[model samples]
Target: MKFRKATSENVQAIVEMIADDPLGSKRENYTIPLPKTYYDAFERIDADPNQELIVVENDIGQVIAVFQMTFIPYLTYQGGIRAQIEGVRVHKDHRGLGIGKTIFHWAIQRAKERNAHVLQLTTDKKRPDAIRFYESLGFNASHEGMKMHF
Candidate 1:
C-alpha cells in the first residue's frame, strides 16, 4: 500500500469508501451523482495549508483508505499545536492487514514533523472494534466526546 495526497479525481472513491460501512451508509450519499457541496469541500481542503486529505492505494492502484489530518494552532497548552485525525477508513478488503496501523504511523510521523503536541481522533461509540484498535495504537479514551449536529 502507498499513501498520497488525495486529488480532485479521488473525491468519488473517497466518498464511496466512507459510505461502505453500515453507519456511513445511513449518513453518506456516495451515489451516482453527488452534490456540488462535496466538490466544493474538497477544493477548500486542498487549498488549506493546515489540512491534509490523504488516500491509500493498493498494489493495483485502487484507492482503499482515506483520512484527513488537521493541524490546530492554539494559545493554550503553552501555545502548543495539535493534530486532529478525521474520517479514517480502510476498504473492506484491506482491513486486518495492518493497513490501519500503517496509516496511524504515517499520521503520527506527520504530526511529529509538524511539531504537534497531540494527535487525536474520535470514533463512534457503536464501533467497539475501532475503539479497541485505536487504543491498541496508543490512543487513550480519557474524555467523553460530545457534539451537536445541525
Candidate 2:
C-alpha cells in the first residue's frame, strides 16, 4: 500500500469509504453530509500550507482509505504546533490488513515533518476495538472530548 495526499479525483472513493463507516448512519446529526461538494472543499482546504488530507492506495492504484489532518500553530506551547487528525476510514475489504497502521505511521511522519509538537485524534467511546487499536499506536486516553450540536 502507498499513502499520498488526496486530490479531488479521489473524492468518490473517499466518500464511499466514509459512508461505509458505522458512524455514517448519523450523518443527519452532523452539519454536512458527505458529498462531492464537500470533497471539493476539502481539496481546496488541504491545498493550503496548514492542512493535509491523505489517502491510502492499494497496489492496484485504487484509493482504499482516507483521512484528514490539520496543523494548528500556537504561541502558548513555546511556538509549537499541534496536528489534529480526523475522518480516518479504511475500506471494508481492507480492514485487518495493517493498512490502517501504515497510513497512521505515514501521518505521524507527515506531522513530524510539519514540526507539530503533538498529534491527536478522537474516537467514539463505543468503539472499544478502535480505542484499543489507537492505544497500541501510542495514543493516550488523557482527556475528555465533547461536542455540541445545534
Candidate 3:
C-alpha cells in the first residue's frame, strides 16, 4: 500500500467512502457528501495551509482510504500547534487491514514534526468501536467536547 497527500483527483473516491458509513446519514459533518465536483474539495483544502487531505492507495493505485487533518496554532500552549484529525474513512472492503492505523501513525508523526502539542479527534458516542480504536492508539477521553449546530 502507498500513502500520499490527496489531490482533487481523489475527491470522488474519498466522498464515497465517507458517505458509505452509517453515522454519516445523520451527521452531515464528518465527510464531504458524494457527487460533489472535485474543484470544491480542491479549493477548500488549498485555502488552508494548516489543513491537509490524504489518501491511501493499494498497489495498483486505487484509493482505499481518506482523512483530513487540521493544525490549530495557539499561543496559550506556549506557541504549540494542535492537530485535529477528522473525516477518517477506509473503504468498506479495506477495513481491518491496518490502513487506518497506518494513516493515523503517519498523521501523528507529521504533527510531531510540525511541533504540535496534541493530536486530537472526536468520535460520536455511539461509535464505541471507534472510541476503542482511538484508545488503543493512546488517545484518551478526558474532555467533554460540545458542539452546537447552527
**TM-score, each model?**
0.96, 0.88, 0.89
- Candidate 1: where are CA atoms >4 Å away? none
> Candidate 1 on 26-135: residue-level lDDT in tens?
99878788767789999999999999999999999999999999999999999999999999999888888999999999999999999999999999999999999999
Model 3 segments more than 4 A misplaced: 27-38
Residue-level lDDT tens digits of model 2 in 1-150: 888888877776777777675677556222244445676687687768887888888889988898989999999799999999988999898899998888789889988999898999989888899899999999998998999989
Q: In model 1, which range of ten residues has the least summed lDDT?
A: 28-37
Task: Show pairs that collide, candidate 3.
Answer: none
Best by lDDT: 1
Alpha-carbon lDDT, every model: 0.94, 0.83, 0.84
Candidate 2 whole-model C-alpha lDDT, 0 to 1: 0.83
- Across residues 1-150, which tens digit of lDDT does each residue of candidate 3 receive? 787888877777876777677877555343445435456766789688999888889999999988888999988788889999999999999899998889889989989988898999989898999999999999999999999979
